[model samples]
Target: MPFIRSAGLRGLRATITSLDGDADHYARLGGLDPAALDADDILMPDLAAATTLELAAADLDCPDLGLRVAGHQDLSLLGPLALAIQNAPTVAEALECTSRYLFLHAPAMRLTLEPDPDGVDGVAALRYDVTAPGVAPPPQGTDLCLGSLHRAIRSLIGEDYEPLGVDLPHPPLAPPATYEAFFGAPVRFDRPSALLRFPSRLNDVALTGSDERVRQLALQHLADLSPAEAALVAPTVRSAVDQLLGTGAPEIGAVARMLSLHPRTLQRRLADEGTSFALILDEVRSSVARRYLETTDLPLSQVAGLIGLSEQSALTRASRRWWGQTPLAVRRVAQSQRTVA
Candidate 1:
């Protein structure tokens, strides 16, 4: 139900020269009527539809096209979030802020940071592919997102700051040149999550444009815009569950506690909406499991733990029920689709 600003759409139109003409045509092609979109924002689904439709209409196939579009966007495109990032003292803190508030920008998607397992001793990463609960991002949206993130970091650190490398879950949608020109580092595909890895030392390096005063003002402005508790409960619960996934199988009571609600209260609330804590937790795990398996390079055992299953065998059983095939089989099918798409 969350929405993205029209800045991205406006940026897209400006960047893609071939799509010139009335904006309504592109909006319509993307499964939306331009008239329906407010001057300020577009429904998230409309944004996704527009993206997919634009790809077909433009006859474009560059995997990094998303990167290009994202790279071209100015800080004005992000508004408050960008203001917060520019004011943060360090790259790490900036990234953390972005990860924490990404739901505001793209509530359906998440951006998580993890230490890179194989990089120069101290490196961290931000994974791509976080999507809305039941919907995947439009095909090129991830590219745009990751590209934008990388560029944002560059703007803070220095334009020449080279990243350690990049990782992507899906195979390339275009030639190697499609990535080489944008990333300026080795790009590995079908690996783990789509990630941008950089030296951990970079985390502490002060951003060039730090302005604590402006950042504080921006933070306050954002805080004022937060939705009420009643509206926040679901996202708060989902976020807490995502954080808890790798620790152990999450319990309803613990999740309730995290939300500062009594277990009974949480149960009654969800039930009133025709669901329950167990269903929500299972749904979250199942959704993330499908995504990690179909997209990321996370191993089954690790993924099992991440999604709250006790062991690999347990994950296998669940996957069988969910997809009617082994997890690996699902990955294989996803891989084949990428190759053929």
Candidate 2:
């Protein structure tokens, strides 16, 4: 139930349409509503979005659908995060911004710049990983992510810049040469994670477009949208809530036990961060309810059960509390929005 911002699928519709495949059709098949997705950024189940890319590749008879989709995107796809990255004074700062804020884009994923596994001097590795348990990022989705990362770096530095190599956890979906051509570097598969290797010196190179004022504004926007501590206690507890919500309302004690913490210790840590277990649980439930309502055609009773509500009436009351409307009303509004879009 890990969710990602729908911006993660920025180029999907265009890619599918260009291939003469039905984007809306494929989107629905992958448990998404194309109309609901196109109007605004919303939370999408990470696995569902990844599967859409995978299924689209097969349907379009294009083994490189992921790369093609990535080719259509750049840092701008990240909105405020892109603004922060592009306006940073140095490549290192840009990368740091990404590592810090990419959770805003894909909560299930992680990005890091670390020492190269090969121990190559003057080289570094930019790693991308899907951190959610039991959900492996499919080959197409991995390619899309790495491909976009490579494109974004080139846009930041120079078009001539190339990674020394790329590492992917899965086998090549297209010919190895195809990946090499796209990344402008050697491609290695069956690796531990998706990675881009580049000269360590690149980190220090200054970006000509750097604007301190713009970067600060963008950073402020991101901060206003989410807490700086989102990466730590909040995310761990949120993840646990997402996992346990299907069975029943997740109690803080159960979550604390899962984290090997005493309930009071967990509460204390959350309080230190200016939040509480109750708030996180409510947020996760709200998000899950919205996803099920807008993206799927599940019955109200089923949706209620999935969110750990006792019955349809409980779901209606919860929906009213969360959205200022009943469950059916929420679905109607979503449907109407899609129709208008």
Candidate 3:
């Protein structure tokens, strides 16, 4: 039973209209007495208030409603994690640090960073895993998480910075056109994960106002505050696979070596965690394939190479099997709305 800090709760409260209409309902739902919330620091359990509003909004067919809520928040809502990111030397370092310290802000979920699954040239993704326990994840909650993360990165990298695209696990509630306009990027629903893709090189861009001392302090604080060591393996393995994808399709032995564990031991451990190396590899490939097809102009042959195929036809075949459409068709559908603009 983890609690999402007041910052997330307040984001939900901001979505309410007419004080007499939803304010009291929100507070009551949250188990709050209406006057105690500070908007910046009120902690709410997922079941008490957050999920109710999230589901209600989705039921009303307003999927992007969470994006509107995220409009009122920024990196400052992340508190010390924000300081850590702002002080890091490069955007990549900032992202790594943020993922390392996810429990501090959003303990219910974690972030997964990966190179383009096909190890597509210059592409990478930072994905959100919102399947934390205690409460079922809802559309509104997913929206806020994605929207705020987008805003948070833009705040760090500059306003004009945008990921090549965003992916969602659920289908769009509004018409595809309306939702696409709000996200300002190509968005695909019913995908494997919620991901934001960008050029991997962006990781090297130095932060404008970084300070090593501040970064060190933030890291130290996160270390002091992180949960038991047992909670870290899955994301660690995924990250290692991400970096290795660009070299070739990732291998369990290579990933195990990177993690400093014997291959057999690593296999056992991942199995105990309810997954396997091959399954993780498939997931990684799928995530990357979808991303590259929709966002980048890489030739199909190159795309196939990056993902371990010997030919473009192999990629076309795989795409059809995985998505029920050819890679070219996926790309065209993603571009259709923009063609009209």
Candidate 4:
């Protein structure tokens, strides 16, 4: 029954050339005036409805047409923007450029790079983070944004670039079919946070000569971005997770209290979205484990504690269930990958 927001409607308008059929479909499903639906509001439907719309639009065969109509219109904007970043002067500048300009097109999202001391030696990697407004979350918009960003960057540089892994805040259910094909890496769910990781060498690439002036100009343009432009979507739940994660052993009841909802209500809502608390917990633990394995000298036992696992044995058991491998085995694979790269 929730309607899409006006901002979302406006954003969708930028991508969609016409809303004729889309409007009729929405009117039939939502029993409202499709013309009255704002671009942002168009994506306010439940996940299943949204996914069906996305798939149907894509199958319609228009150029970037499907992406345009998707409720999270940010995916359509990231492509050209990432291409611009790839043309920047150096890897450092390219990353900086991406971090800076990404908001101009997508808003509410930031990409950062940090140096890894242990994993991949001295390689620096980029992280994509989304910040949106209100208690309502962005749904799967985060994944779409990350996927589009990855595809754009790969196209600009070269397809051999390793795809970034994501740390989702919910359990996996019926994810989009193109997810594995596009991400080309593991996608962990119900994690404490979302993340994207790749080797830092891509940062060394020289920026296209013509882009330097544009980068400077874009910086000035971004300086004017409003706080609402970087709105934090689903702040209530995100804040609850933030506080709970600090405790090392957060309970669902505790989290529910923090969000001012009964545990039963929380569970129902999460189920409506096809996720659960246990799945989110495993996702967070798995992601933290991977990051520790790839980026630090932390022992397996220590890594387990960081992600709320009480003992190494428990961590191993959970990892095997989620990934069909032991934590050490996963680390070994990552190590081998680093060696090959």
TM-score of each: 0.77, 0.68, 0.69, 0.46
lDDT per residue (tens digit) for residues 1-341 in model 3: 67666676455555665222365565675465554245656666655545555544644445566776778778888788888989999888898888878777666677877765434788898888665521235666777778888888888888547677778766675577765676678888765467787778778888898899988898888778777753657767866775576577788888988888999999888888888888777666666676566656678787777666678898888888878999899879856743652
Query: Could you give candidate 1's per-residue lDDT for residues 283-330 as a string of tens digits?
Result: 788877887877776788988987888889998999898779998998
Candidate 1 runs further than 4 Å off: 18-24, 33-50, 61-63, 117-120, 229-237, 240-281, 296-310, 320-340
lDDT: which is higher, 1 or 2? 2
Q: lDDT of all predictions, in order shown?
A: 0.69, 0.82, 0.71, 0.53
- Flag regions of model 4 displaced more than 4 Å: 1-24, 27-86, 105-107, 115-125, 132-137, 175-178, 224-341
TM-score order of candidates, best first? 1, 3, 2, 4
Residue pairs whose backbone atoms clash in candidate 2? none
Off by over 4 Å in 3: 18-20, 30-37, 55-62, 117-120, 133-136, 230-235, 238-252, 264-341
lDDT of 2 by residue, 1-341 (tens): 78787877887888788888889998899998786347437888887888788888987889999899889888887889999999999999999898778888877786767778688999999877765532345788889888999899999999547789998876677899999999988898755557899999999999996889999999989988775656468777876787688678889999999899999999999998889999888887787787667645779998888788888998888888887998888778867865673
Q: Which ten residues in a row are the worst by lDDT in model 3? A: 130-139
Candidate whose lDDT is highest: 2
Q: Per-prediction RMSD in angstroms?
A: 4.3, 13.0, 7.6, 13.3
Q: Give the best candidate by TM-score.
A: 1
Tens-digit lDDT track of model 4 for 18-107: 643454453345343455344332333333334433443444443233234333433234444444464567656766667655555444
| Order of quality (lDDT) | 2, 3, 1, 4
